[model samples]
Target: MPPQVVEAMQRPMVPHRGPEFSEFYIALIERLKRLHRTEAEVLLWPGSGSAGWEIAAVNLLEPGDVVVAGVTGDFGDRFALVASTFGADVRRVELEWGNAIVPERLDAALRAAPGAKAVLLTHNETSTAVTNPLAELTAVAQEHGALVLVDAVSSAGGIPIEFDAWDVDYLFSGSQKAWMCPPGVAIVVAGRRAWERTRETGTHRFFWDMDRNLEMTKKGWTPTTPPISLLYALDAATAMIEEEGLEAVFDRHRRLGDMTRAGLGQLGLRLLADDAYASNTVTAFFPPDGVEARTIIDRMASEFGITLAGGQAHLASSLIRIGHMGWVDDEDIESCLTALNDVLESV
Candidate 1:
């Protein structure tokens, strides 16, 4: 976390229902709107990004509603599972773990399940380190008359996402990723179409009710007691993003991604994600033949004090992920790569 964000969180708490809190909450929402590039109602929930998926599913889907989910990685599969748990007939467009979902494949799935209520997408799959073609995929889903629900948990503030331009029905992200804040808050943006669907869905909801949340939002408050400290951190982090400029922040991530990928390649390691659709926030790659992913991760941490994430599920033994998103710079990537190279050499 940034120094300002830490300082903001350390400040004394205020009354959640008071006028001072309302003003602060309203101002933060406005900044979040600018960040998302949307005029839709942006809600901050006291939950993780995964909770946003369930909130969206229950509010927008009726039991037995058909959903076309693109299963490109662990997170994508989890979103599909959430929708199915809420009673949606999730028809997954399954892909290999390291591959991205192409528009043609998604279009075929939507056509196969005609009249599907919605399409679930992960904007950037951290588990696979692939950024799906969101705009093109959204167009395809909309053409099939399906609403687009996106999980931008790992890509929201780092990568370029124009929610209004894409006409996304619903999109949600976390405060911990590219927002440069501690975890706790789930940021959700609901478009006009999604709000209309929420009114018609037969699914039951209370704490996650969008309608009730919308009412409280009008009064500049949350339905439940808010996470005030996390909110303070978010406010400070968002200000830093604005001061540095969103485009500049995105450019830095892109440069770091390029540097990391090139360094890994020069070290004789193979990248898991295709170069055509690599993620700017995280990069996944395989260790050299004879070296285990665990060996590299453990050595990098114990020897260099640089923590790296291992792959998820089936890819756990073979894949490793390097995050280069919020609060990271060129030198950070360089140091990580140097340590990784040393680890590989010794192994």
Candidate 2:
């Protein structure tokens, strides 16, 4: 976390029901709305990004409802699972793990699964380091008259998302990724259609109820006690984002991604995602011919004190992911690349 975020979190607490807290909550929601580039209703929940998936499923879907999920990686599959758990018949458009989902494929899937209530998508699949074409995919879903729910957990703040322009029905993200804050808060943005579904759907929910959250939010309060410290951290982080300008922040992430990908390529390392669909926040790549992913990760940590993530599920042993999201810069990417280069040479 950044120093400002840390300092903000360290400040003393305030009464959750008081006017001061209400004002703070209202302002934070506005900032979050600005970040999302939407005037839609934004809800704050005390949970991780995974909770956002459940929130979307429980509130918008009923038993036996057909939901089409574009499964590109682990997160996308998890989202489909969440919807299935909530009794939605989730028909997944499974793609290769390292590739982004194309619009034509989604359009075909929707055609096959007629009367699908919603389409679940991951804006950026961190597992594969691929950013899906959200706008085009959303357009296709809309054409099929389906509500579009997006998991923007890894891309929201780092990547440019025009929520209103795309007519996205619902989108959610967590505080830890590009928000530059500690984990705990799940940020949800819902449009008119999603709110309407919440009222008509009979999926049982209490804590993740969108209706109750909306009622309380109008009064500048949350239905339950929130993670105040994380909110403080986010408040500071959003201010920092505002000061830096969203366009500039996005440009920096793009530059960092390009630098990391170019450096890895120069070292003869292969990126998992194609250049056209590569994520600006995280980059996934394969290890050298004989080097193990774990060996590279361990050596990078033990030698240079730089921690990297291994891939999920089936790709666990073959892929390594390097995060270049919030609180990162050109120098940081350069350092990580330099250390990775050394680790490969020594191995």
lDDT of 1 by residue, 1-347 (tens): 78999999998999999999999999999999999999999999999888888988889998899999999999999999999988899999999987999999998898899889999999999999999999999999889989999999999999999999999999999999999999999999999999999989977799899999989988999999999999999999999999999999999999988999999899988999989999999999998888889999999999999989999999988889999989999999999998987888788
**lDDT at residue 194 of model 2 (Cα atoms):** 95
Q: Give the TM-score of candidate 2.
A: 0.99
In candidate 2, what residue range of length 10 has the lowest lDDT sum? 196-205
Q: For each candidate, what is the lDDT?
A: 0.93, 0.94
TM-score of each: 0.99, 0.99
Error of 2 at 280 (Å): 0.4
Estimate candidate 1's RMSD in Å: 0.7
For each of the candidates, give the backbone clash count.
Answer: 0, 0
